[model samples]
Target: MSRKLSWGAAVALVAVTASVTVSLTYVYAMKSFNTKVADINERQAMYTKLSEIDQKTRQDYIGSVNEKELNDGICAGYAAGLGNSQAKYLSAEKYKAYLNGSSEKSIGVGIKTVQDKDGNMEVIEVTPGSPAEKSGIKKGDTIVSMDDKEIVRLTYGDALNKLDGAAGSKVKFGILRRQNAAGPSAEAKAALLSITVTRAEYAEQTLTSSMINGNVAYLKISAFTDSNAEQFNNMLAARIKQGASGIVIDLRSNSGGSIRGMAEMLDTLLPAGNTVSYRDKAGKTTVQYTSGPNTVNLPISVMINRNTFGVAEIFAADIKDYKKGLLVGERTAGLGTKDEVKPLSDGSAIILPVADYLTLNGDVFSGKGIGVDIEKELTSEQQALLVRNQLKGDQDPQLQAAVSALIRQGASVEKAPGTENAPVNSNAAATE
Candidate 1:
């Protein structure tokens, strides 16, 4: 079978193999070249249109133009055109500050807005004990101006950046507020209000525990960070070791955080089974996390409010669905999803949503919050006081209701001691 070929035949075979290899290489090279050319052409079209606009503006512009603003606007417009509501283009400076992401107790005025509707910053929330809250800034208030600069006239990111500064610094805000002391209502017309607030550090990821009523333990989860989740397990075990029979988990005003962190905390509490899951666009179901076999045997009670959002809702939902605890307070905020930030070469960036969210039982609670077993409501003032570390003991009705629920679930109660119950907020604490 081992036979040597003739020189002429061998030469012909070599030629055939070399020709095929060269043909494949040529085809691949052409495909790559064509793809690059198409990309360059697309970019050329965009640049051409932009140059035309710039040329016209230079030739017949009316007033002085801020080149920095114009450039930032163009980049921001491109991101906005992507059609993702959560998409926001951060300028170079903003991107830098964002990367500087701090865990400081305080950085800016404690006003949170998720929307820039109608060119005005809509005030969706104000942190308790924050300079904004102390200055009478409440939720539903519209930020019309920052330090006398109209918000509509300035870039939104720039305005947001202005909100951050050193502690003890002052910033002035022009607020357009509803006449009603509560949230927004159609009956009240918007009134212009102005106030100055001093910014200070606030405890951002507050997680602490104490013996509640001698037998029941109390844990306040402000934000679900990995550190906090780990701390939670240790604290819970310590509380249990101290002869605590049950626990009251307060999650009010927690806008939520890392899903992994939430799952970790749940793992310490839930029995072996599926914890939470999510579905992608391709209609495939993926289990996000599952609980271990060991769970602390105790009556659990979770405190929730309307401001409880994202992962916090999932925490509350798991507790409710499993019937492991009774949910006390108002309905949740009902907002959760996965978001990703992509930075561009020019130092600009975009924040966009990448996936949807679902609760433990595979239910979509987005836009609609989970329900509570025991409904205990509070006024805005009371809600603020209850968390500023000012609200405690008999002063907080919701806390009382939660403790009472635990008592009904076979938890032993004793005389309320001089225990400190301070709130940990999901958002960074700031005075604005």
Candidate 2:
């Protein structure tokens, strides 16, 4: 009787297990089918769009459009649209390397810093288990000197570049820590921290956006990575849906990403068609970024500074030339070199310039930055006020200027306190 009961229990358990396996198999199969369907739909849509673009090509032009030119146009247009006009067309290997996002090497003392008030280089964040962190480097500590150069004037990019060297190399640093408001106390001695960090590839997240003042949309792009164009398009659509009026594009410290990505962004904003032109290696001039319908009618104010560089320069120049919106703040950092990311056999990458970049009207912006129409230089007192607002963690000055300018141009600034109407005082707003 006991043997019979045990056999029955085993049979029941086996049946239950079989049922679960069948159910799970069905669920996974359905999920895979749905994913395949979605991929097909996306590919279909892409094919249709490309077909449309190609359908319009005149036979003469089509015959002459070599593989290189087509690829170059696509790259240039995408870069121009996204505001990084300095992007050079990348070959397959180079594009692969660009997509990898891996820095060729990493140095010890993994940390990052930004400028603070009183012109000090303050450590913003320290990587855990990094040489710097292990050697008593803390967040909020001031980095006085690295090797020899003062950190006060080095841009964040320049500072990082200085910190990077061949693996197994040691770099000296002098640091200061501000314990309290009494002023920064220097470290008792220059901490000669040493570490041999093996060079490893790392991925950096490149796209981020937010709504400012509950309505104004602000987009911050660090570099033109592979997914930047697609991400920006989706974000812009979202911002428009959220009732974004004025856009303050903060490209202040953007070191430029991809030219093709820039063009893609421009296509979303401006009417599509040949927005930027470039000369390829074959001494042939090509135009890309045929305009699309201008979608958002909102006033755009692009914020740039001495740190805004690379393809960002092309954006400021082209947009200003087209009289699309206002370029605000200071002159941009003129880094107009379009580099091809050449991946070597050893898995290292070299960014080489293939061709010169040009504006739609044939203006060259490489090494020459775009100047803003409204130059709002901050006085020392104004700089202090800005810094205070910044320390309080406000990225609002450029937005304020953008909104104010738009308001002056007959747009409603904002609803006055205890008033039903969004009050409009054009002259006062302009002066402000």
Candidate 3:
């Protein structure tokens, strides 16, 4: 009876141990399966998002954009060990300096460059007063190389960089010239010339005024530079106090700068409570209102041409709209949009158009350009004649016309070359 009880107890013990072992093994297997299933689901979700991005890019909606294009734009950059092996990429600041434009003063070699049909660079213009012009560098001269450097594959940027250095530097350029293609079968001839140029400091200002013939004030503005607004304010004050009756504001060759400068000047000219509204992206509108008293309420005539752009156009349009001044001579350069410069990771930058400008009447002042109140062009004889018969004077015919228009409006005049304090009536006398 004792042996039977011991055997039964051993059997029960084995059965309980096997059941617990089986339950633990089943639980471990179920947990492993769940972990793998979760990993697959997460990967699938990531791939789905990528697909959506791709699809949206292909659709040409304003809301949709190409991820690749945006990434490769000026905002993004190259990965490690990428780009041209032989070339050095510029930094962001360096690229910005290139776009900002620099004043280069070289002892006037006067070589004008143009791109050829085969993409070869050539000289198109040369000023007679310049050193290169004196050195027999003329039009139709093809530039082959410079300073022992081959320019066969060099880009326009690279070539320009090579041309720059400290003042008094000498650079030799290899050129080829073709006389004629229609009559002669002569091949282009090669010419090697060395031009030594001493660079000078060039100062550009937005506002410049000088009193001619005692009373008439002539103000020539090139651009709305940062320092120019203050200068303009002080100059205007002085001119107004000087008891001037007529003003000639020359905007010819003046590519406009800051819009703020335009508004500041407009404030001095326009009455209070009136506003100048400009348009931006998405048809959004921005307005700048006149907030101060008017300055120099005298007879005025503005000089304009194909080079008068941006804020210059806006100013001209404002003057016409308010009937403040006579818009004399030619049309304006129709670049009426605002742009923002975006820097890239690899140092390249892009200028993106951001806004469109408008008049006080909500008119778009672009594409068609600002129209002139008086239509005038230089005659063949007037165009042939150099300004004041001097080396440096106005080449723009519109400038001569502006002076004429001012005198026509019964403003005092200073005739160039013959007599002092002479009142001229005819256009010939005005031009002379």
Candidate 4:
């Protein structure tokens, strides 16, 4: 039996309960309000400081300031302050050129270069049949001068800028080439030769495929820019048709590109499943892509290095998650964060991180990059030789490791670890 409360006592209890509930609600509301107020005040203080500085500059600055440059500087500085290396602000003109550059098309003499240890711009790659090649610029040549402008240690970028101009325009260059092409490199004599190259608009070859080690196909993917899926498929199909027992994909310096392109490339091999997902700072995960079911399961080997970034990391991680391939070479660059290119009203743009990429297994390869099953490191000299196209056949240790792994895995590829393949729908993404 329960004891009944008197009406007056019950009324007193109800009043105390209501008072406590109201007090908690008030406290919570105040806490939220105070937080919002603090945030607003902090933002106001920042704006006030900026306004004060702007006023001072306008009043007493001796030099005439270009408003556009000043604004761009501020934007660039703000992005730099974020400490995200990939975050950047691009002016309208640069943004336009950047967009145009993504098609693997260029309006300059086709030669890719890197600043050598000697601080000289050394040619690493010369596009086939390009004006640079036709004009006698080889893979190992160094540009000494461009259009009478000396390409010294400094202002080298300015000198290379001269390579870009109206189509059909000719650019003169002084190239230093080794006289002894096949002799000992340290002792080889070099000569400076002057040549004229025409700047023409042409598509760049993003990938190269060849049959190596008799039954294996080797594909070097330099960058992930333009959608090269069709070409990639054609090359792989040809290799498969030619009895390629294993496939080795070299993404040593492949900074990722189109998410769709990566998906297409991976879809050619990955069975239908959750390939990758995106997780925000709030821990909300949205599936990025579900791979289609039609698959080309093969004894696959993915060769990566410290420079394999963005979607390339995703590609390799996906393969690893599916037990689809052996990742050979160094760990990936681990920069698998997604950035959004937000355009300003003035036609300029800013890129900033929007979220992080998550593998199908809920793995984050952001700052902590993807690891490989076979860890083979490349010496700095050998790495230089690699990007410079100086690595001869059977000389790349990482490639050798990949080839060996593929050969070993070829016989039991289907029996490799991981759950059974499942069918799924569309997905893909990437960066650089």
TM-score of 1: 0.63
The parts of candidate 2 lying over 4 Å away from their true place are 1-111, 114-121, 125-139, 144-159, 162-176, 181-207, 280-283, 288-291, 341-352, 380-398, 409-411, 415-432
* Tens-digit lDDT track of model 3 for 1-432: 879988998888888888888988888888888888898997799678766865676775567565545654413333222332212333455455454443322332445455555655676445445556556666657777666565667765576665544345566776666554454776655545544444322333235676544555657676776456677767766775776567778776577877777777777776663545667877888775553665557767887877788888988888778877889877987877765666665666655556777876888877778989888765545433322221123444455566666677777664642133332211112210
Write model 1 residue lDDT over 246-304, tens digit each, in one string.
89898987868778888998888888877777667776777878899988789898999
Clashing pairs in 4: 256-431, 259-428, 259-429, 259-430
Candidate 4 TM-score versus the reference:
0.84
Model 1 gets an lDDT of: 0.77
Clashing residue pairs for model 1 = 105-202, 106-202, 109-431, 109-432
Query: Which candidate number has the best lDDT?
Result: 4
- Worst ten in a row by lDDT for model 2: 423-432
Who is ahead in lDDT, 3 or 4? Answer: 4
lDDT of 4: 0.79
Q: What is the number of residue pairs that collide in model 4?
A: 4
Global Cα lDDT for candidate 3 = 0.62
Answer with 1 or 2, whichever has the higher TM-score: 1
